[model samples]
Target: MTPAPSLAELEADCWQQLATALEQKQNRTESHGFQTMTVATCTHLGADARTVVLRQVDADRKYVWFHTDARAEKVIQLEAFPNAVLLLWDPAQQIQLRLTIEPRLHTDDHVADDHWQKLWVGGRKQYLSAHTPGSVQPAPYPGFPPELGENLPSPEESEAGRPNFAVIECRVLAVDYLRLSRAGQTRARFEYEPNERFNWLAP
Candidate 1:
């Protein structure tokens, strides 16, 4: 029988999985693990959850990044609360990760500019909406200009979205990992702030 992995090993594996997911953009199954995550933020009413695409992952720095419209409700919520949770699930691997993060928003700054330069036209189009996010409309809006449908804008045209593009940098504080398997199950928590804390939890 294979010996169970140590807490440290399990923790390392968790980070490795995230790093792999970030780099494997062509592998849909692996990429989906990092490509989409549910972000939960606090609001006056309570918690708000939304699906967001993962833009970058820095395993060494223990940070994750996502792009959003600066004027979005979630951006406002993060500005007010700053602390949020990112939930990622990989159905193929039967692994789930809950990450606590301190969010820092970058807008109208060099950080945002740098990220904006890396965005392709398809990505830039998301911020090109004439209406702000969550605004009530008399008619349904396609999010972007109707003329741009199914066609990527030129580099110069895509620049129109720069003002609305914002990057949310998440400084990871803790990660709870759960893996389900027929052989057995594994659960662990890795905490980075206050001190490095790592432990295996009962599955």
Candidate 2:
């Protein structure tokens, strides 16, 4: 990694990349490279990571959101230690963003409800699956409720998992953004602590 740019430049670049990534709904694919990040959580045993979708991002780019099953192991890990890392990479952009944050769970309230309401029927169907997340099954499982029966479940069925559904709110403490291009590679970092500052780095 080479020396990074001053904090101001880093921050500006981060904002630009983040905004651009969000604005483009389709860039040769359905999801933005930032949407699915490798969520790293600390457990008593060690660190664990899994890919999760990017549910929402604040205007300031300081906050990001993801949804998960309440029964998931990561939920338990977050409760123990809220600090986590979201690692995002875009093969198309040849860029990677590493966000270190403190995660807060949205249990029940307007925040969770609004996100739930925004979900499409197909998305809502995920919660209707009867099988518990991470549970052992005798046969191959698709991670959904058995016997979906011709139509999506009523609001009640979807709501059944509402309690089990959880939203992960990440308040970014730092973002390390790296970009690779033909015009040489560039890397930078922006930190929220010790005052907001951006620093350039060697690719």
The number of the candidate with the highest TM-score is 1
lDDT of each: 0.89, 0.78
lDDT of 1 by residue, 6-71 (tens): 988888887888778767763555444656899999999999999998778888889999999988
TM-scores for all candidates: the values are 0.94, 0.84
- Report lDDT (Cα) of residue 22, candidate 1: 67
Q: How many steric clashes between backbone atoms does each model show? A: 0, 15
After superposition, the stretches of candidate 1 with alpha carbons farther than 4 Å from their true spots are: 26-30
**Per-residue lDDT over 1-203 for candidate 2, one digit per residue giving the tens place of the 0 to 100 score:** 87756667666666666666665642434555765779999999889999997777774758888888878889989999889999989888888889999899986888888888777666777776577788889997766676775668776667666766778888999888788889788787788865887677787
Give the best candidate by lDDT.
Answer: 1
lDDT of 1 at 15: 80
Clash count for candidate 1 is: 0
The CA root-mean-square deviation of candidate 1, after full C-alpha superposition on the true structure, stands at 1.6
lDDT of 1: 0.89
